[model samples]
Target: MAEQCKISAAIVAEEKSCVLKLDGYSRAKGLLKNGEFIISALFNVGGHDWAVKYYPNGIKDHADSISLFLLLESAHAKDVKAKFKFNVLNKNGEPVSSYERSDWGSREFVKKADLEESAHLRDDCLTIRCDVTVIHGKEETRVPPSDLHRQLGDLLENKDAADLTFQVGGQSFSAHRCVLAARSSVFKAELLGAMKESSAGSIEICDMEADVFKSLLHFIYTDSVPLLEIASNKGETDVVMAGHLLVAADRYNIGRLKQICEEKLCTHIDSNMVATNLSLAEQHGFSRLKEACLQFLVSPSNLEAMMASDGYEHLKSSCPSVLKELIARILPAEYKAAKDIILAI
Candidate 1:
């Protein structure tokens, strides 16, 4: 027998959508007569030009209704078949299925009287969404996922084209000044702006550990923190590392990383770590984290346990005002009044 081979092909439909928001619908109705239309701005979909025609008083025959039509505007385009749907959007900007119309070209979309009374028309405005799916008689090709971050991370790991070095906690770290400057305003000012470190070959970073700096560099290169991911599986270490990363992020003016660290610390609050987290929050003026810490301290048992924790004394000495705020948060009005009177005496 002869060997046989078969080829496979699949049809693909590329979909795109545009929304036409008709503001001042009542004004449009007053300005445009029946059969007259307002054409939407030309939009491109699947390599073909398209536009929507909105008739305020409807086309000639359907005078009582609002009309919508999707027109293929490419001048020389031929044999381009597409499926389209016109949807009347509700008050919350959601499509109402009852008002949906699917067609090849024109549609008398909604009755003007009905639409005027419905929630779909609000603030003298109405929104219509048109979805077009262009069919192609060819197989779709697979597109690979983006690896830009991976490539950048590889560059960092290989230390290729490094222009600056940081001496942090007695350890040396190589980095690209452009990359650091691009990621952080503080780094940008220090490395590129009129600062002393801008001209220095090696800069010393104080009050930050080498490991924390390493993790920060990873985030700068790859926009990720594998250290934080790994730390999440472990308990106390995760909270402690997140707190450290939060401070480092704030110092470097890395807003997203700081938010991520703050969120992580907020979720990981326990009696043992609450005092330390509270102190950090107070010093950094992190309102959300401070609120989370105070909420954790609302329980009498948690408060007692936090008072006996290792960080309690540090929290007291470093942020006495925060402790006073904590007392006000957990105390009743009458008791607070009594305490205030006693202090006055």
Candidate 2:
């Protein structure tokens, strides 16, 4: 049977607009970044000043747009530009600092920063905000589009304080409250400067390790670090080589090298990998390998399921306590729940 009923259709839409004041800007542009864009640019974003690089969407009516901010972290008089490169230029252009370049890899990062609740920070990065309508392909690409960058510049001109100081590799410097000129005396003195050699050894040949130091120096300067220098035609697992790799990674924020070490640690999470990654992870405590091991211990399944099964006995024999903890946690919660339900039934 079919029944007829009254029907009506209508489309009602309205355009939304807001003033691009500093507060409004902080609110809008804070939504754009995908977890720390070119951190080098972080010290320069935001202010009551001229326009900043923020994207306001018009396509899907506030669906998407890129926004960036400069965040500064300081501890006991040291500045850490806590921004990670998230934009295309640094992926294709020159990077400013290791910190700016230190997210490991671009595609692997997550977290579209929503600063609505945690917008306030004494050491927080600069904030940029924009609202883009969802329907436009890229509202920002349209030239002469309404924007606030000029306003950001104007505000920056009058501001007296920077976001914070910057510390990179191990050196430290003060961040300025300016538009970060494409070229600057400060950058020349800081970023493009040279390191003063302080080794007591002669510039002449010395020891086997000094040569490795020379390699580190070359890489920190040119970003062209040499591959693992196996002294012999044969390959050997030298802890010193891993140390140099870590040094190169620390100085340049080379994510591939870092991942290689991390995977090397995970693959051999054997006592050997544990011993090595423990030191490296302790040195760099913010790394995720710590969580990786923590999760691995409590993993619902065993690595045996995915790999060959010769080494479990060796692991059981070496670190029995750790092995027992791993086995206890790996047992599925479903197993216990099913056992309990069977008794109940």
Candidate 3:
């Protein structure tokens, strides 16, 4: 016989409740004389308007007593229902007595005699509390965002309906031309325009490695890349992949992919990678990434350490014009302050 197992689930609340309170009951008593009712300030509960009504002297048959009622202050196509709990707090700011209802409506909640007997009133003042949980009515069925992307990703993985093959670094990748053109402007022009590669069934990609091309194709299909966990030191490999992918994104004119790669590279910027990243940023005209790299290296704390990196020499050689600005920033404040004395020497 098979063993039995239990499965459980629950509806987690998506929104919070609204609490309504009424204070200064004593002073308002005299104003609410002659059985006149005083309504509390408007409060919102679950997108509907509501208020508390207090009758200083009881209405109708309860003339010798006070009455309290919770009212729906706004009109609705259907009744706005809620589960509520009412409380009369003591002078110590604790609930002396309470009433709970799973589904409360507009009705008299307390009578004067009951309030006086329970010692809920002090100095002719009383406190009223309402905790409301509005019924959301019904749950709507919907499709999750990941489903479509996952289906496209499945198609890519299966290489189903492949119409083009890309030969990158001795590796062949099968992909659909329609999908590629739809996702990238560069791909659209190369595959659809009067380009030599558009006439061929197979295209050759040089400079970019197979892994980087694969990652780019994965993003084009799935709208995401394989997880590159950034917490471990081994994640450095992933960061390097991101740098290469950033270049691919720029070449292909995939703005979103470029932004994603730039953000990932920014998170992993260090002494060793800053120079390379800055060079790539400058080459690709990535203003944000370039600014971030500059800001990271120009700080007095990191300036000297970053200068020692091997890539820094390459950066200086390739972009010597930027050195003047960097030199100005690297000069210590004290050096500038004592410049006159040095000049005298």
Candidate 4:
């Protein structure tokens, strides 16, 4: 029972003829209705929750997550700023997370304790209220410095996570899981029921490095994931984080996160570690990773190109059979024969 928040949209073209696709139950006292979006604040009041708040018998006016993302992405690169923020709350009308307009801000994470505050206690619902801003029409908008879109585009274009176990600071990770989780929602929407329908129960991620796993968990809940780089010296620019994230993304069928991982991988294609991982990408059905692996294997010079490429370290220990199969797939049909001949000679 709060008043409507009458915040304004900066885009001049949207000043008129905009519909308030606003969900009445939204806690934001005033969520402005405009083109492609009705302004919503992340602060959730107890009354209206989005997770189960269904639209009246299917009126498709308010945008779905993909539509909003597309509308945002379609903005000219220079017009898009590198930052976004939201003000979120839980059921008890307490601060779940919030942010004001800033040049660069990521989605705030809600902790388990915060969940306790949810008025409705829906696992997927969060009390959210906040305005979004786009820096379009400027001489140059602040897009991320790294090329996330390109890496993902390469993988999707080719098909797959580009399967490489990203080792950052010496810790190994599964690239496939990361990409899938990141881009999962997109897949859920686009594929129209292809995602692995979660069983009518909960899921707990298996054994994972605690902090890294937590970071990934955050990514699962919120599409906005913070970038963490493991070994910049060896050219692992967020590969560990991005690689693991891709696997999670793929698992959840989130498309954008997968693309972000692929883009990150493409940025450092020349690095031996990346090439080796790309080789492993195929087993996971990461067509792009498979393709990258094929490209590197084509150049014997690249395979001969080893700078501490402990190629099979993680899998040989944990998944010997799977790794062996991958090796067989990677090597030529005559590779075993050639090895036997060399031993005899």
Best by TM-score: 1
Query: lDDT for model 1, on a 0 to 1 scale?
Result: 0.81
Q: Candidate 3's residue-wise lDDT over 175-276, tens digit each? A: 999999999999999999989878789998889999899889988987775433221235467678888989998999988888888998888888878888
Ranking of models by TM-score: 1, 3, 4, 2
Report the candidate with higher lDDT, 1 versus 2: 1
Worst 10 residues of 1 by lDDT: 1-10
Clash number for each model: 0, 48, 0, 64
Please give, for residues 1-345, the per-residue lDDT of candidate 1 as tens digits: 001111111122243777777777877788788987777777778788888788788987889988888889899999997778887876666777546677855546777876765556778878888888787776366575666776798688779999889999999999999999999999999999999999888999888999899989989998887566545445687688889999999999999999999999999899999999999999999999999999999899999999999999999999988887777777787797865754454
User: Candidate 3 clashing pairs?
Assistant: none
For each candidate, what is the lDDT?
Answer: 0.81, 0.34, 0.67, 0.41
lDDT measured at residue 226 in model 3 versus the true structure, 0 to 100 = 47
Best candidate, lDDT: 1
Q: Flag regions of model 2 displaced more than 4 Å.
A: 1-212, 221-240, 251-269, 291-345
Per-residue lDDT of model 4, residues 1-345, tens digit only: 223423232211222111112334344322322222233222211111111111211124322111121123232333234233333433444333221122222211222232232332344333343333433345363475554543453354343634433343345443344454344565334233444422212223454454565555445444455444223333455566566766766765656667777666655565456445654464466777655655654555664553346663553454454334444555677699754444454
- How displaced is residue 187 in candidate 4, in Å? 13
lDDT of candidate 2 at residue 217, scale 0 to 100:
34
When sorted by lDDT, best at the front, the candidate numbers are: 1, 3, 4, 2
User: Cα RMSDs of all predictions?
Assistant: 20.2, 21.4, 21.9, 17.8
